[model samples]
Target: MPLDEPAALAEGSSRLPTLEFALTGSTADYLIHASPDLLSKARAFEHWESTRLAHGLLPFARSLQTPPAAHTTLREQDGRDVRGLNFSSQDYLALSSHPAVVAAAQEAMARFGVHSAGSSVLAGNVGDGVALEQALADFLGLPHVLLFPTGWAAGFGVIKGLVRPDDHVVMDVLAHNCLQTGARAATRHVHLHRHLDVDHARRLLTRIRRNDPHNGIMLITEGCFSMDADSPDLAALQALAQEFQALLVVDVAHDLGAMGPNGQGQIGLQGLHGQIDVVIGAFSKSFASNGGFVAGRSRALKEYLRYFAATATFSNALSPLQIAVIHQSLKIVRSVEGEWRREQLMQAVQALRQALTQEGLTVWGQASPIVPVLLGDERRARLAVREMGQRHLLANLVEFPAVPRHRARLRMQVMSSHTAEDAQQAAATVAAALAASAQLMPQAAQTP
Candidate 1:
C-alpha cells in the first residue's frame, strides 16, 4: 500500500492530489498529498518508491477545501441508499433543518441575499451575528462571543491570538487538530499526557511552570472532544489553570447543544463559567448551523474582536441567517423538544455502549455521546466500513498521523435526533461486522 514519495504528481515536490474513492460508500475519502516541505518532499520521493498508498492524506470531511452540499449524503458501494441514517452527524437536535432555521435562512436571503452581500467590515456588522454571539456568550456563562467561519479557524485563533512567540501552550496529546496547527506559530510545549489523565496534565503544568515561570501558558482542550466523546474534567482543568496561573481555553464544539444542564455546553453545565478563561465552540455541531466562535469576559472578547482574531477581521462574517437560526436553535436546544431529543440520544448512547461492551468491543468514550470503536490497521479499518455500508450505517474511518499509526478507528458520534432503535441497529451491525472481520484483522478484534 506504500505510495510514491509524493513527487510523482504535479512536480515541485508537493505531493500530487491522490484520491481514494469510497470503496466502502462513506465520505471516508483519502487524499494524497505531496510533502508540505519541498526538500523533504523531494527526499521522500527519492527514498520511497512513489507508490499509491504511502502518500495518503487525512480523513475526507476535515479537508474543508470546499463547502459540503446543503444536504448531501454519499451513496454506498453496496448500492444501498443508506444515507438516511440518524447516526454519524453533528446535528444534535437536528436544528439545521428545523422549520424555524430554514425560515430564517430564507428570510436572510431575502434581506441580505445568499452571500454576506459584503464582508463584515464593508457589510456594516450584521445584527444577526452580533445577536448570536451575545446569546452564545450568555448561554455559556461567558460575557462575550466573537464568531468565525470554522471551528478550526477559531481554535487556531485562540492560541495564535493569545500566545506570543516566546509564550507556551501545553495541551492534551489528544487535543483537536486545530490547536496544534494554530500553536505551531508559537512555542508548542506540548505535553502528550496520557489521554484524559488529569493528573498527568497537572504534572505537565507544574513542570512547565517551574521551567518557564513568566511565559504566558495557555491550556487548550475540547470541552467534549469530537473524536473521544469524553468530557474533560473541567473542574480539574479549572483548578490546574488557576494553580499554574495559565489561561484556560476550552473548545466546546462537541459539547455545545449535547451537554450541560440544558445544553448551555459544558462550561455552563460545569458551573466554571467565570473560572475558565475562555470558551470556544462551533455552530455546526449540535446547533446544526455552520460557523465557530470564541467566548470570554466581555472585555476579553472585545479585545479579541478588536485585535485578537485575524479571521474575524479578514474572513467573511458568518451569514446572518446562520446567526439567527443558531440563536433560535440554542434557545430551544434545552427546551421541551430539546430535552426529549437529548434523552433519546442518551438512551441510544447507553444502549450502544453496553452492546459494544457486551460484544467485547473497545468503545473509547465514557459517557458523552461520542463513541470510538477501535480497529487499528488502516486498510482493514476502511474495509470494516465497507462492511458497515453493507448494513446501511455509516461509520467514520480515521487513520494515522491524524491518530497514532496503529490507532485507526471507526469514530461514531451520536445525534439527539437518533432513536434508541438507531443505536441498537448500528451496534448490531457493527458487532456482526467485527465478527466477520475478526479473522481478517489481528491488530485487536475485541474491545471493551
Candidate 2:
C-alpha cells in the first residue's frame, strides 16, 4: 500500500507501465498533505493500493494529457500536433471556440476581473451571474435555477442538500459518479436498478414505498447515459415517480444542449418539460462553458439549495467570463443557428454510427451525439485506442469499472463542427484500428 509497491508489484510485465510519483514515501508519510489525520493517510494509501493493479495494467487511459481544442481535431498525447478527429471532448455543439462566445468572454473579462474571488453566497455573486441564472431558468422554462462551479457539483450538491439520511434514493446503476457519491453520502438507503430498466425501477420503488411510505424518496437518473449513450424511458420513469410519490432528478448534462428542438434535450424530446420535479444539467457539454445549474418549479427550492448545498455555498461561483460565455452560448443554442448545429451534430453521429455498424461493430443507444462502439475485450479496447491515436483519430477508451468488465468500449462524441467527411474518416479509422488491435491482443486479459 505504499507508493513504491506498484512499481515493485508491476515488475517486468511489459504490459504494465510504471508510475512515478513525486512523493517518495507511503501515503501515511503525507498525512500533512491535506489533513493532519493518520486515518485519512491510511485510507488514502488503501485507495491507491486498490487501483494499483489497474494502474499497472492500463496506464494509458489515465496518462497525463491536454486537449487543445473543441473541434474534431486535437493534439496527440506525445506532444505532437495531429489532425486527428477528436471524439473525446464533451463539447457536443462545438460552441466553445465560436467567435461570438469568445468575444463575449473577452469583453466580460475586460469589464470584470477573471475570478469571482468569493463564494456565490457572498461577494462572488455578480450581476451578470444573476442574469445568467435567470436566462437559464427562462431557457429551461423552469421557475428557479441555482448555479454551481461544475456539473458534477450540481448533481452532488442537490442530493446532499435535499436528501436526509432517513430518505431513500433509487438511482440507475449507470448514473453519474457524482450522483452516486451524493446518494451514498446523503442517505442510508440507496437502491440501484439495472440501467434503463424502468420496470425494475418500478419494482424497487414499489418495495421501498411499501416499506417506508412516509419518508422522502428520490428517483435519480440522467437525461442521457454518458457511457452507454442510451436514454431511459423518461415518460415511464415519470409515471413511476408519480405512482410512488417520489421526486425525480434527471441530470441532462449530455443531451440538454445538443439534442431536441431548440436544444431542450431529453425532457423536451419526451414532451415532459416543466413536469419533472427537478432538472439538472451542465454547461460543459452543450453550453460550451464551465459550471452546472439545477432548476425546479419553486423559488423556495432554489433558495433552500443556495443555503444548504455545501458545494455551492462553500465554493466560488462561476467566473464573470464563464457566466458571460454561458449566457452567449445559451443565446446561440436557442437561435436558428443552434438548431442547424444540432442537425449537423446528429447527422455526424448517425453517419458514424452507421459506418461503424456497417463495419460489423456494435454501436449502442438511440440517436445522440455520443456513439459508443462496444469492445468487450479490455486488451483489444486499449490496443484500439492506441492504434486509433496512431492513425490520427482520438477516441476515448472506457473500460471497467466505468462499464462492466466485459463491456469495455470506445466512447466517441460527435461534434457539430465535424463534417460528413470527418465522420466517415473517423469511422474508417476506427474500423481499421479495431482490426489491427485484434491482431495485437491475441488473448484477452483474464478477469481480475
Candidate 3:
C-alpha cells in the first residue's frame, strides 16, 4: 500500500491520544498484558502501528524494488517507487553484485538445481556445502566450523547447543538479540554486563564463578555491535574469560570479511585472531549470501553443535547456490582484492562520518560501516523518517527497545561502492530531513 503523507490529526480525537501513545510509547510497554487472550493483547499495539502506518510515519517493512546496491529503488507502502542513494543494506564490501560471485551462483544453480533438500546432518551436505565449511574454517584459522541456515540461527544455536541448564551465561548488555535469546533459552543464570566494559564483565564472571563454581560459564560479546557501531576489547575479554575459567564467544557478523587487515575483523585487528575461543559470523553482511557459521578450535565441539543445535539439525541446509556464492565471496575476501575493498570501504566510512559531522549531526561509534546519527526523541525520529523518505535518503530508523528510550537514531550502513559524492548527498539529505522533522515537533505536541 502507498503511504500517504502525514497529516495533522484533529484535536481531541481518541486517536490523537493513541497517536501520542504510539509516538511516546515503546514495544516493551505492550509486550505484557493482563488479558488472558493471546490474540487480543496485541490490539492496542496494532492500533498504534496502524495509526503510524496510515500517516506514513512507520519506516519499516519497506520493499526494495531492485537489487540492493549503492543506489537503488524502493517501493513505498502505497506502491510508489522512490529512488535514492542506498545506505540501508548491510552489503559492507559491496560484493553482492560482483561478477565472479554472480557467476558462481549461476553455475551452482545449473549444477545443483535450487534447494539443498535436506538438513546438513541428513543428506544436505553437498560438495559445495562441504567445501564452503572447510573454506570458512581455513579463512578464520579455526580447524572446525559448522554452518547454519542464517546468522541468527548460528548465533542462537551455538549458545543453545552447548550450554546446558546448569550452565551460566555472562553477556554484554548490548549483545545481539539471538545471543540474548539463546542465553535465556539455555539457562536462567544470565548476567548482562555493561556495554564494552571489560572490567564490568570481569566482575560478573568473578561473581558467577564464586556462586556457581561447578557449572560452565559462557562469556559472550560482539566483534562489532550493529546498532551502536562499536566493538569490545577482544584481547581483554579473552583474558578475562580464561582467568575465570569461562569460554568466550565473539559474534563477528558485522565485521568479518569487511574490516581489519586480511579481513580478520576485530579479532585480527586486535591481534587476537586465532586465539579466540569461539567466533561466530554471518555471511549476509559481507559475503553476499544468506547463512551463518560457528568456528572453533575444537573438532569435538563442532561435531557436538552440528548434532545438538536445533536450528542446524532441524532447518534445511543452505542451498548449493548460496554455498557457491559464499565460496567465491570468501575467495575475494581473502585475496588482495579484498584488502583493496576494505580500504575503499574505510575511506567511504570516513567520508560519511566527516560529512555527517560537518552537517552538525551527532554520529556515534567508531569508524565502521554503521554510522548512527542520534535523533534522541521518538517523536522527532518518526518525523525524520518520514522526511527521509520524502528526501529520498534510504537509511534505517532505530528507536526505543532497540536502543535506550529517548535515544533513537538513524543507522546508515555504508558500502565500499558508496562514493564521496554519495556520502555528501546522504549527509545533506539527513541534515535537511532532521531540520524538517524538528520544525513540526511543536505542532505535533499541540495536536495530541
Candidate 2 at 358: error in angstroms? 0.9
lDDT of each: 0.67, 0.81, 0.88
Candidate 1 has its poorest 10 consecutive residues by lDDT at: 21-30
* Candidate 1 C-alpha lDDT tens digits along 38-129: 56544443333223222322223322111222222554322224443435566666666678767877888788776675445556358877
TM-score of 2: 0.86
Q: Which structure among the candidates has the greatest lDDT?
A: 3
Q: Write the per-residue lDDT of candidate 2 for residues 17-108, one digit (tens) a residue.
A: 22322111233443444555656555545445444333332223233234434333443333344456677777888887789999999999
TM-score of each: 0.81, 0.86, 0.94
Better structure of 2 and 3 per lDDT: 3
Candidate 1 vs candidate 3, lDDT winner: 3
Ranking by lDDT: 3, 2, 1
Best by TM-score: 3
In candidate 2, the residue pairs with backbone N, CA or C atoms under 3 Å apart (3 or more residues apart, or in different chains) clash, namely: 72-86
> Candidate 3, residue 74: CA error in Å?
1.5
**TM value for model 3:** 0.94
Write down the RMSD of all candidates, one decimal each.
6.0, 5.4, 3.9
